[model samples]
Target: MKNFLNKVLQQHSLIYKLILYVLTVVLIVFLFPKGGKFKYDYFKGKPWLYENYYAPFNFAIQKSQETIDAEILEIEKNSTLYFKFDEALVQDVRSNFDERIRQENYTSEIVEEILPIGQKIISSIYDFGFIDSQSESKLTSETLEITLRKGNLAFNIPPDKFITSTELLQFISSSLANSAPVELRSSMLNILSEVIRANIHFDEEFTEKAKEERIKNLSYTTGFVAESELVILKGDIVEGKKLEALNSIRRELESQVWSESNYNWVVFGYSVLVALALLMLLLFLRKYRNDIYENSTKTTLIFLNIALMVFLVTVVVKIDVKYVYAVPLCILPIILKAFFDARLGLFAHVLTVLLLGFIVPNSFEFIFLQIIAGIVTILTVSELYRRVNLFISIGQITMIYMIAYIAFTIIQEGNIEELNWFYFRLFAFNGVLAFLVPFLIFLYEKVFGLVSDVSLLELSNTNSTLLRMLAEKAPGTFQHSMQVANLAEAAANEIGANAMLVRTGALYHDIGKMNNPMYFTENQSTNVNPHSDLSNVDSAGIIINHVIEGIELAKKNRLPDRIIDFIRTHHGTSLVYYFYMQEKNENPEQVAIEKFRYPGPNPFSKETAILMMCDAAEAASKSLKEPTAQAIDNLIEKIISKQMEDGQFMNADITFKDIVVVKKVLKKKVKNIYHVRIDYPE
Candidate 1:
């Protein structure tokens, strides 16, 4: 167990990466929501093209959401709120008023005389809410409920009505005799009004409780579905009540109870389906594209792309199944292909689509349309650098989606008129969103340190700041780079390597010469050689210093690591022959070959290896005084063959066959540069 844990923790190991891959895929699948899906996808106002749905079990038919919402709204609007009669409020009001009327600052005869009469009028009224009214109060104690603050004082009183404000005021006036002075009577009435306020308050808790009760008692279902009854018939338009019934059947089907025995099988099926799809992706990378499989960054990007697509579909389906078509499924393949190859992108997209099939409604149709769109995406994105290619490819993918959906609809309904136009707009919207893929690729490049052809194309531009400086400062070296770029690009194409990568690498390989342009022979335009004054060893140091300078410049410019690889390995540890021979003659025993050689980890890829050959062959061809076809051919063959003999191409994974192709392409390209013509013309 300790050994296994160590293996898992060793992130540098391939075994650890594989374990991470499995765990990540498992976790993503497990996070998916377990929602129900109907066998057939039916749209409102569309015909039911599939078989009829029957009551699968004795499940209760439920009301529609709209109906339930409307019922709840009505219950809230009509349900009366109960305000318990608080006897304490009335007592508090009476005590505050009695204390006020006794404070006799006016000391009037009428005020003192009518104070008791006012107190009697206020006390006679039990409900203090309507004491100032002129009309007579009319409330029975039966309907109205009264509540007190004392322990266990909650109770429902008999039916009773509340006292009107007019009635309470009239009672207060009548209790004050008419002949007992009008001024005193008016003052007594004002005192009665001061004590008047509502003892009754609305009870939210009781009102909400009673409202729920009313809603529950309301009839949820207007009708029932008999066992084996056809809820929706084939060829019938599914709208209005028919659509509602079909949805009810779906809800009922999902609500079915699962036994313990098959419950494990449900989980097992999901595990096998998700794992098998992901395993196919893993095995494909291991077998066909081990370079990508070996790198966890690229591997994670591919898997994460698939997981995100699945997650979007799963979440969208859960929210509303109709909007699932709006998901940019093609974007997955486009994104993966931008970072990797077409095969990987297509495989990952197909796997994701199949997994989503388990959850998306009408799974067959969804898979078919998406798989076709993914294929279209892969084909159109063969060259993704250009903006036009992106636009055209998205157009083609959208067209495929629209056409495939139409064909599927016709097949299912036996006519073209049943095709859903909304799905076409969804596909069009998906295409519009696909334009954002280039921007996404930019983000992935920054985050993952990946360099695609689009980036290479931009880097290869001669007008770029670095390359322009290389051109302005070291014109001869820049010209050499241009020639070498052509040769390397041709060789890469012939040998089935990344031609764009090699071309981009060739354009920047000699950028180090810009620092000491005149020290290099190509940039030295005159007979004067700076090396003539320096010692042989010192001159070799300067020659070797260019590679170091180029690496530093590339790093300073923040060029991608892949492009910098060209500057590092272009010479492939080859010694400066002229200086080395001079040093050997001066001091044979003291000569250090390492100082004369370019500091190199050597060419580590087929493209870098080809660049090495092209760089050497192009530079050497420029020195030939008597240029001929045989001479150029021999020069190209000799340089590459010697490098192969020195084992400089060992780590490049290139075969001798690929080397022969590179040599042939180089000879032809060099011949064209010198404009070699047939001798028969003379």
Candidate 2:
């Protein structure tokens, strides 16, 4: 057994790697426990499929947060101010009045006249008591009262209601006659004002604690039912208190302690379902889009994005199930489409939405809307980096979501008025978030080294530093590259290949000619033939060196491998024919065909093969004497046929029909280039 285990461990084959990856992903999926699934997800006023439910336990009815908050607010409105009355305040005021009279040296007769007014003011206020100005609640104030708590005893007194602070002062002054002595008036007002102190204050801390207890004590469960009873018949619209009661029981059942047998079986079943979904994704990629599957970075990015979408749904659902629509799920397709092809984008989106259905409420509706939105995104989005395409595609996606959601709503509830307007806002917000695709594409390019259409578009510009330098140093080669780019792009567009990629590749294909510009005939403006002084072998050697030099130049300049591939495979294994034949005539027996060949990994993709055809056809076309449409057509046929004989396009995954289209397109384009122009009369 030990030896067998060692043997198995030592053999780390592709199958073993695949199993390891699947297991790792499954383990991650297992990490997020799928909570108990209730049969129906009910919002208020929605029809339910399940029969009437009954409470399984004697549980308190829980109140909704909105309901409890409203009641708590009302309790606060009705609450009266609390205070601690000072029994000694009255006695203290009397003593101060008597002492002031003695200190001022007032006559007994003057004191008798003023003392009544001062005492009357103090007595009237003291009888009423100084209450807190919770004076804003006038309607309640009329009937309002405060409790002056002294230990265990409480006294209820009418609240002091004053519209303004001046109300108290006005009452004091109005009690005196208008003709009264000024000294007596001033002395009486001053003396009375000093004795009045506010004995009542709002006890905020105590009131808050009381309100909280009352809110907490509110019933969470409104009603009860017995088990094995029909809570509602099938097809009943579960709403209002009925909906609330059913949800409470559902929560109870979800939270109920799982038995050893039940827990194991449910977990196992859930794991299998998750694993099956993952397996289907893998199999689809491996079968149809093997390029994505073979590249671990692409596969990892796909899985990670799906996992991220699922994780977002899980977290949002956990916080509040209603807000699940706001999680920006549209970002999944845009990001995937940016990095990969549209088919792969739609595939991953559908799979992710399906996986999240287990957790999301209304699984069928959620799946339908998302899948439709994803389809719209894939169909409408042509170039993700194009600002207009991204905006229009996102708009279409949002519209699809809105239309589909409304349709689903009408089908479910049979009313347009039942549609939730907030969901429309959420879908709109989701569409706006689709702008993240370009930024995410940038990050994916940086992290995974994946190229996107946006970067390809930027790279296609001829005014870029390297392309500009190539034009200046080797104008002939730059013009040739431009011709080849036009031909390749046309052919690519005709054959449903990536036209932008091939065009960008063609623009930089011959940059190595810049290193020794004068040696090539096109760049040599003088009649001097530099190759005439060298042996044919040496000349062929120089020509062959351009491929290696171009590769080095591309790498130094940090071009993508896709572009470098055109530089590498444009000549493929084709020879520098003129020099090779000249050398072979001198030493026919000793000449090796390999010596004249460009160091090549022949074209391995449709784009590279198209560039190869375009590059060779354009360069060879320059040699035609008496250029005509028929001559150009014959030349194109001869050159491309020769390349085919040499097995140049064996690995490019292009069909014979596609090659026919490319040949037709290239011939038409080349013919137009050399078409005769009649001279005009002077």
| Model 1 agreement with the true structure over 125-237: per-residue lDDT tens digits | 76334322221222233325433222245554432344555466776778776534675667667777776665555555876787788988988776777777777778899
How far residue 66's Cα lies from its native spot in candidate 2, in Å, is 5.5
Instruction: Write candidate 2's Cα lDDT for 1-682 as tens digits.
Output: 9998888876644455477457645654664544566676664556766655555556544555657667778777776555555557766877788677667778888877766666666676666455545532332535566665654777776654322344666766776545346757766766666666655455666656766777677665566666555566667777666666676666665556557768778777767777787788889888978877877778878877887788888788778877777777778877877766788888888878888887776677888888887788778887765799788877888888889988877875667987879888988777777777788789989988878889999998989989999999999999999999999999999998988889999999888888888888779888999998998888888888888999999999899877888999988888899988888899999898888887888998899999999988999999999778888889999998999999999988898999999999989998899888899999
Q: TM per model? A: 0.65, 0.80
Name the TM-score of candidate 2. 0.80
Q: Candidate 1: lDDT over CA atoms?
A: 0.79
Q: Which regions of candidate 2 deviate over 4 angstroms?
A: 1-20, 40-106, 126-163, 177-200, 256-259, 319-323, 380-439, 461-469, 486-496, 514-519, 533-545, 572-604, 624-682
